[model samples]
Target: MPEYQRIHVSYNGRLGVPVGLFVAVDHLRRAGRLSPDDEALWLTVDDWFIANLPEPPQYSDGNTAGVVTWFKPPLPAAMQRRVEVATGLLSKYGVPWSISESDDPGEIVYEDDFQVAVVPPVRGEPSPMPAGVTLGPTTGGSKQSLGTDASAAARRHLAYYATELADRANRPASPDRQRQLAAFIAQCEALELATILEVGCGGGRDGVALQEAGFDYRGVDLTPEAIDICSEHGLAVTVASAADLPFEDDSFDALWTMSTLMHLDGDGFSRAVAEVGRVVRPGGLVAVGLWGSEPPRRRVDEHGRLFVRRSDSQVRQALSRIGSVETFETGQWYDDGEHYQYFTLRAT
Candidate 1:
């Protein structure tokens, strides 16, 4: 396994820091100087910094503080050489950068008008910060909320989807999803279940099918526009979060969510699943669908929203924590060669 290295990329002050940083990182990846994992780390760190970029200290005129840090993964010797050769590339685009090395994790080894500080990771230690870089204070001593960021991203995604709702509604449901829905309905029928809650029911595509199949369905989503669209079709819908469903305990006999929980990170996913368990009666059915990959990872979409792709075992393990996973499967659900995992769970 290749060791990871932290590369803190900072600028004095700039308007398009995130976009510029992304361009540089993508250039390195395209030139084969950075691996896919390296690119992912770079983007993740960039997103973090962009999301948390501090306000200028005390009446500063600058629009941004203009400092960002990233943790770069270990590069092979060849890649390192390529990177060295490409050192002056960003400067061509008017983004000057200085490179510095550090053995201690989180120590600022160097600083100049342009600095790229490198720090090694210390196992089991809280993440380190370079010298003189302080994250803003937390409110009420509570940890900084990723939830806020997630909600903002969710809003942006939903807003984008809102503009395409008609096109999405006309698209046929994936055959795998159709089969999974059929199987879940069969199980619900066997248990004489009636009420169903569909979380993240964007345009009510599947929700309409569930209602047509004689289930009492209620759909919830974070996007009001989506809810409005669904409601126009005579579907019961509301705006809500999967992590904090407004329904009471044992309020539903079954829960269905797809391509939704993946928007959440591991902790958020777990909390949402726990909430699912809470609102669902014991032995109620749950069907979860998400894109899957080995070792579960996060990636930013074109809209800058973070999505986690879970492995089959990872999905099963997560569901097992809340209930028994009665069925687990995966298939190519899109023409784009992307595979999706579906799990049928029985709430404990």
Candidate 2:
């Protein structure tokens, strides 16, 4: 048997270590090394950590034999305990490992021959890794640099979504979204609108569904990768920003967008709404879906993207400038316990 080597795994305050430990525990379970009670405990702890801890910015020196991540300082004591438990589990499995606050190698050897795997934390299912003792070359450093500038942050957010297209595609449509789509399709049928435009149609999920529902649907999104995925599915999509739509005036009978306009700030939001008004014909309908708040504010999501929360009154005020607000409601539409605001408006 090849000798197990002592490897230094660097982790900031994120859940990368616990996820790795999850993999390790799974390996032991498959090999019949973990008792039922211990396996349950490991899984419970892993779930707790994943639910409570924010995902860290993922990094790995591909050629190295360990994980790399960066975290904000003043790590909480609870999180530290979790990390200790993860490392303890690894030690119990006879995998020699150590945690470092910094990524500097100092004296530890992280060569390609060492049995280390640097797995990044992803939403949904854990990404698979090679079986048994296997090592792969380390790729380059972190793909993105953390920053606070609004424009740069927005760009990074789009890039992140572009990369996450596959993951999002695998996820089932949210119940609230399905409800919204059903309502929109009914409205289109009532209005006798044969053509519809979907703004910010990520991955073209809604577009495909709308087409199947017998409406001529065209989609637009800022991310090229999302557009590519939509094209592969045979949906008509264009790469364009909502702030500056490329269609002629009054090009469509109705427009539908959801959870996308929230990415724009106040000024960008106004511009995009103006573009929406310009694209839909007189007496056409527009359905807007967004997360709601009484006091509007801007915040960064887990993927380092900017999101603007608007109140129901604020949404009405914005859309009222272009037409009449026919319907408005806010409710907890997802498991996150946060309410989303949905509005249906008639273009004057």
Give the lowest summed-lDDT range of ten residues in model 2: 138-147
Locate the minimum summed-lDDT window of 10 residues in model 1: 138-147
CA lDDT, every model vs. true structure: 0.62, 0.65
lDDT of 2 by residue, 105-138 (tens): 2333222221222333332433344366343221
lDDT of 1 by residue, 1-348 (tens): 223233323532123332234434443443434322233333333343344433223214331333334334454332332343234334333445554444443544433322333232332222343355433322211122422332345545654665777777778987778888888888889999999999989888999988988999998875545765787778987555687677889999999999998887767789898898998899999999989776556787887567888778877888898889887778874554356888898999
**For every candidate, C-alpha RMSD to the true structure in Å:** 18.2, 18.6
After TM-score superposition, what is the CA distance of residue 165 in candidate 2 from its true location, in Å? 1.5
Give the per-residue Cα lDDT of candidate 2 at 64: 35
TM per prediction: 0.56, 0.56
